[model samples]
Target chain A: DAGITQSPRYKITETGRQVTLMCHQTWSHSYMFWYRQDLGHGLRLIYYSAAADITDKGEVPDGYVVSRSKTENFPLTLESATRSQTSVYFCASSESFHSYNEQFFGPGTRLTVL
Target chain B: AQTVTQSQPEMSVQEAETVTLSCTYDTSESDYYLFWYKQPPSRQMILVIRQEAYKQQNATENRFSVNFQKAAKSFSLKISDSQLGDAAMYFCAYRRRVNTNAGKSTFGDGTTLTVKP
Candidate 1:
């Protein structure tokens, strides 16, 4: 109940379609992040938030939009999904803005774009 | 931009033997942090160890220990007396110590370690 949770654990979508992945955390962490894992490339950050209403781009933030309307929620929206966007998405949270602190990760959402 | 690299993509070790996973990172900032995370077949992310760039001492967590050479920008994970349960994908991550709005850790490609009986 206290850990991070991601909705729609498995999803299949069509190209050009809009899809949103939801992430929720009960820990009240100050920072939240979204990452995508690809074969050979590993997990790459898509977007992250320092706090509610504060978000920044990561290494691969293109084609993705994220909003943190509240501290407990950070949702990712793919305005126009592409086949290349097919990957496992993960959500993580940390107690503070410091990088050294341990981060709690959600179970991840596997999205397939056909 | 900070880049983390895990040189070995896969490795195998006999049960009860020791194994080491190598990791290297490039960062312009002098202050930063390093970490190792383990993901088993279940895909659950688990923390193994962490090291601060400013700390001279290496970080150890039970059977797991990290050889953090800040000057060389190398952070390797050593698993002593490894068990079959240790088989998993291990990742090396890096982040700046200066602090920022992004609470993300730059991750390496990852190494899949196999513990053979």
Candidate 2:
């Protein structure tokens, strides 16, 4: 596919275990984001990157870590997964931060922490 | 900080009928964007429509349209001639125009739409 993609469509992890979710995009977009979708919260951004090696925290970024060493890749890691971290993770990218450019989202990764 | 709110948790529409999902947002930035995303059972987030804050004309895409009230801080999505494929979770989101902060979107809780044939 030419759009963004997330690996491990579904994942199962234990509490206190470390897990990393990988995101890749073929568009070479300038901005990429990581968000988690829960039942009542919709999608909350965990982190976002402006370009390679430039990342920033979002609304919920306490236990999560993200790095963008390349424009085509942005991986989010959970140092110590918790039960509350169980949710659907989505990766998105855009050509720029401008309002005119819409963000393209991936199929999402369903992560379950037991 | 920006916050998006979708008040209706669930909605139902009969085939060929129309349904509107309401969304409201709070933001201090004057120039920004509003978007409606549809997530079907497949869990892929698809952009349904988008509206720029500065544009006076509403945005429409096929059977999907939006009523953007900038002064009221509201953006609602309307789906006409509803089809079974239209049944999905609809989310409203807000984003800024500038690239200084990466333009992260703030999403609403989402409205689940059910189309009855």
Candidate 3:
């Protein structure tokens, strides 16, 4: 309740369906990020927000969408789920964009697209 | 673009022993940061250690330490007095120091480390 949290710890959905994964943080950190972990690819960043209403794409951003309407919340949406989207999604928050600051991660959400 | 590589796919160390995991990166930027993250069975990503490219001395934390080689672009993690709890997937990551690209990190494929009791 005090740190970053991810909703729907596990999910399974059919391809072409719309799915949304929620991430919330209580620390009020200015920077929030979304990353997907895949075998042999490690954790690839999908999207990141420097502040509310400010988001940018990362290494792998295709088929994924993210929004930061509020500082404490950053949700990732799959416009049309594909089997290739099956992976563990992680949310991270940091106080600033400084390299010295460490990112705090949430309990990842494992989503399976069938 | 920067890339991080963890050469070892798997590694094992007897309890109370020491082990090192290797990592390499390709980058042209002069200022950046390196980090090692641990992900246990629970799937939580925990920061183990971090090193700054400008610093010549390696960073150490309790039983965990990093051998940072700026010229070679190598950052390796060493675990001493290993325990069962140390078993996890370790990731090496690199991040640019520039504010515009600071939050995005490039992570290696990760090495799964097993501790034998």
Candidate 4:
């Protein structure tokens, strides 16, 4: 009954439009992350939050914004969605930022920007 | 920055057969962690198995096992008695040790595994 969830499993928007992918975890984990899955390239981190109000950029963060107002939620927003940004977005959470701890992933959101 | 590499883009094995997926990484850090994550067609990232750099014994989970060669910097996943459910995209990942900045995961391109019935 308790696990990470992502909303709007599928989304479609026009170029230059704004879109947000939501991620929520019930475990109240201290660390949350957003990653985009591109073909041929595994998963690239977009952003990660260590705790509420504490966030940092990951490998690919140029076109994204993240805010952790609450410990359970870390949402990613694409200010101006481009076709290049049209990819499946995955949300993950971990107890600690340390590597030993495994990350739990959400179902993922498939975004399409026309 | 550390990098993960999965040279095999695709591989296949018959049911009940054994297969190995290759992964190599480059990292200057001595203490770290290595992981094998499986993504089925459902797209959920499942933790297959994990190995700590400090451990000499390899990690195993039922039908899954890993051959980790630290000096050669190679980690490969060996699945015995493969099943149809084993069909998925397998990714090799690395994470730096604690007390290090940028506590994030670096993943390889991924190897697509197909199970032949």
Candidate 5:
């Protein structure tokens, strides 16, 4: 409850379905990030929000969408789930957009697209 | 664009022994930060250590330390007195200090480290 948390720790959905993974943080950090961990590719960032109402794309952002309407919440949405989109999604938060600040990670959401 | 590479796919060390995991990166930027993250079976990403490119001295935390070579663009993690709890997938990451690249970290493929008791 004191740190970052992710909802639907595990999920299973069919192709072309829409699903949203929720991430909440209690730290009120200014920067929040969404990343997907896949085999051979490691963890690739999907989107990052510098602050509430401000978000930017990362390395792999084609199929994913993210929004940060509130500083404590950053949710990632998969509008049309595909098998390639199945991976462990992680949410991270930091105090600011500085490189030295350590990121606090959530428990991660494991989603499977069938 | 910056890239991080963890050459070792897997590594093992006997309990109480020491082991080092190699990491290399390709970057033209002079100022950046490097980090090592540990992911255990529970799937939580824990920051093990961090090093700044401007600092000549390596960073050390308890049993974990990093050998940062700015010129070679190499950052390796060395674990001393390895324990069973140390078994996990270790990732090497890089982030540029510039504002445009801040908050975005490039992670390596990761090396799965096993500790033998």
Candidate 6:
């Protein structure tokens, strides 16, 4: 597909285990972001990258790690998953930070940590 | 720090009727942007409409419109002639206008809209 997509639309993991969620976009957007959607919390950014090899933390980045070695790919990893970390993960990309640039989001990855 | 709040957790409206979702934000910056996003069961975040802070007039997209009150820091969405397809989670978001802080969006908890026939 020409749009953004998330791998493993659904995932299940145990506490303390390591898991990674993948995101890919065909738009070659300069900015890529990872966000988690939980009940009562619409969506909070976890990490974002401006370009290849550059990433920054977001509101809920305490236990998450991200890498952007390519403009088309941005993957988020959980070093030690916890039940608190279980939520729907979404990946988004925008052409630029300009006000006219609207973000395009992937379908989302629902992760369950038991 | 900027924060967006959607007071209504869930709401329902009969088809062909109208419904409004309220959103309030706290920010010190003068120039910024407010947006409404819709997410259906498919979980795809779609931009419903957006309003620029500098503009005095509100923003509208077809059946969707926003009531942006900059002084009051309020941005509410009004949907007219609601349809069954309108049932979804609607989120209000804010973003700074500056390039340095523009890529990140601060989102509200979201308002779930249920449409009945």
lDDT tens digits by residue: candidate 5, A55-113: 99999999888888999999999999999999999999999878899999999999999
Which scores higher on lDDT, 3 or 4?
3
Q: Candidate 6 DockQ category?
A: medium
Better of 1 and 4 by lDDT: 4
Compose the digit string of candidate 3's lDDT tens values, residues A1-114. 799999999999999999999999999999999999986558999999999999999989999999988999999999999999999999999999897799999999999999
State each model's TM-score restricted to chain B: 0.96, 0.97, 0.98, 0.96, 0.98, 0.99
Give the clash count for each candidate. 0, 0, 0, 0, 0, 0
Stronger candidate by TM-score (1 vs 3): 3
Cα misplacement distance, residue B2 of candidate 5 (Å): 0.7
Provide DockQ values for all models, in the order shown: 0.67, 0.73, 0.81, 0.69, 0.77, 0.76
lDDT of 4 by residue, B1-117 (tens): 889999999999999999999999999988889999999999999999999998989999999999999998999999999999999999999988774443488999999999999
Model 1 Cα lDDT, one tens digit per residue, B1-117: 889999999999999999999999998889888889999977778888889889999999999999988879999999999999999999999877767633567899999999999
The candidate that wins on DockQ is 3
Error of 1 at A69 (Å): 1.5
Q: Chain A TM-scores, one per candidate?
A: 0.97, 0.97, 0.97, 0.97, 0.97, 0.96
Candidate 3 residues lying further than 4 Å off, grouped into runs, are: none
Model 5 lDDT tens row, B1-117: 899999999999999999999999999989999999999999999999999999999999999999898889999999999999999999999998987657799999999999999
Q: lDDT for every model?
A: 0.91, 0.91, 0.94, 0.92, 0.94, 0.93
Task: Mark the 10 consecutive residues where model 5 chain B has the least summed lDDT.
Answer: B95-104
How does each model score on TM-score?
A: 0.96, 0.96, 0.98, 0.97, 0.98, 0.98
Model 2, chain B only, scores a TM-score of 0.97
- Cα deviation of B23, candidate 3, in Å: 0.4
Q: Give the TM-score of candidate 6.
A: 0.98
Q: How high is the TM-score of chain A in model 2? A: 0.97
lDDT of 6 by residue, A1-114 (tens): 799999999999999999999999999899999999986678999998888998988888999999988899999999999999989999999998685579999999999999
Worst 10 residues of 6 chain B by lDDT: B96-105
